[model samples]
Target: MALYITDECINCDVCEPECPNGAISQGEEYYRIDPNLCTECVGHFNTSQCVEVCPVDCILPDPDHRETKDQLQRKYLALSGQATAV
Candidate 1:
C-alpha cells in the first residue's frame, strides 16, 4: 500500500529526501505523500525509506490507496520506464 504522513509528523524534513520516488512533499501543514508516485520503495529498496528515516513515526499506510505488492511492483516498473506485466 502507498504511505501517507499523519498529523503526528513533526515536520522533521527527513522523510522528504528519503523517498526514492520523490512522492513526498511539503504540504500546508506537514509532508505529504503522493500516492500516484509512491511505489512503497519496491523498485528501490526492500522497505519504505521514509518510514525508516522518520523520527516521529508518522508515516503510515494509506488505506485510501491500498495496493498489493504486485501492484506496487508494476508501479515501480512503470515509473522506471520498464514494461509492466499484464
Candidate 2:
C-alpha cells in the first residue's frame, strides 16, 4: 500500500529526504505522498525509510491505494529501472 502523511505532520522536513523514490513532497498543508511514485520502499529497502524516521508517527498506509507486496515490488522495479528478485 502507498503511504500518506496525515494532518498531524509537523512539517519537520524529516520524511521528505527519506523517500527513495522522491514520492514525498511539500503540500499546501503538509507533506504529501504521490501514490504513483510510492512503492513503500519495496525495491529500495526492506523497510520504508520515511516511516522509520517519522517522529510524529503520522505516516500511515493508504487503504484506498492498497497493493500487495508483489505489486509494490513491480512498481519499485519500474520506478527504479532495475531488476531484482522479489
Candidate 3:
C-alpha cells in the first residue's frame, strides 16, 4: 500500500529526501505523497523510508489506495518504465 501524510505533519521536511520513489513533495502546509508514484519502497528498500524519517509519525498507510505487494512492485517498475502497468 501507498502512504499518506496526516495533518499533524510538522512540515519539517525530514521525509522528503528519504523517499526512494520520489513520491513525496511539499504540499501547502504538509508533505504529500503521490499514490501513483508510491511503492512503499518494495523494490528499493525493505520498508517505507518516509515513515522511518518522519519526526511526528505523520506518514501512515493510505487505506483508500491499497495495493498488494506485487502491485506495489509493479507500480515501482511502471514509474521507472521497467514494466507494464498492472
Model 1: per-residue Cα lDDT over 1-86, one tens digit each: 99999999898899998999899999999899999999999989999999999888899999999999999998998998896467
* Models ranked on TM-score: 1, 2, 3
lDDT of 1: 0.93
Count clashing residue pairs per candidate: 0, 0, 0
Q: Following a full C-alpha superposition, what root-mean-square deviation does model 2 have from the true structure?
A: 2.7
Query: After TM-score superposition, what is the CA distance of residue 35 in candidate 2 from its true location, in Å?
Result: 0.4
Runs in model 2 lying further than 4 Å from the true structure: 83-86
Top TM-score prediction, candidate number: 1
Cα lDDT computed for each candidate against the true fold: 0.93, 0.94, 0.90
Per-model TM-score, in order, reads: 0.95, 0.93, 0.92
Best by lDDT: 2
Give every collision pair in model 2.
none
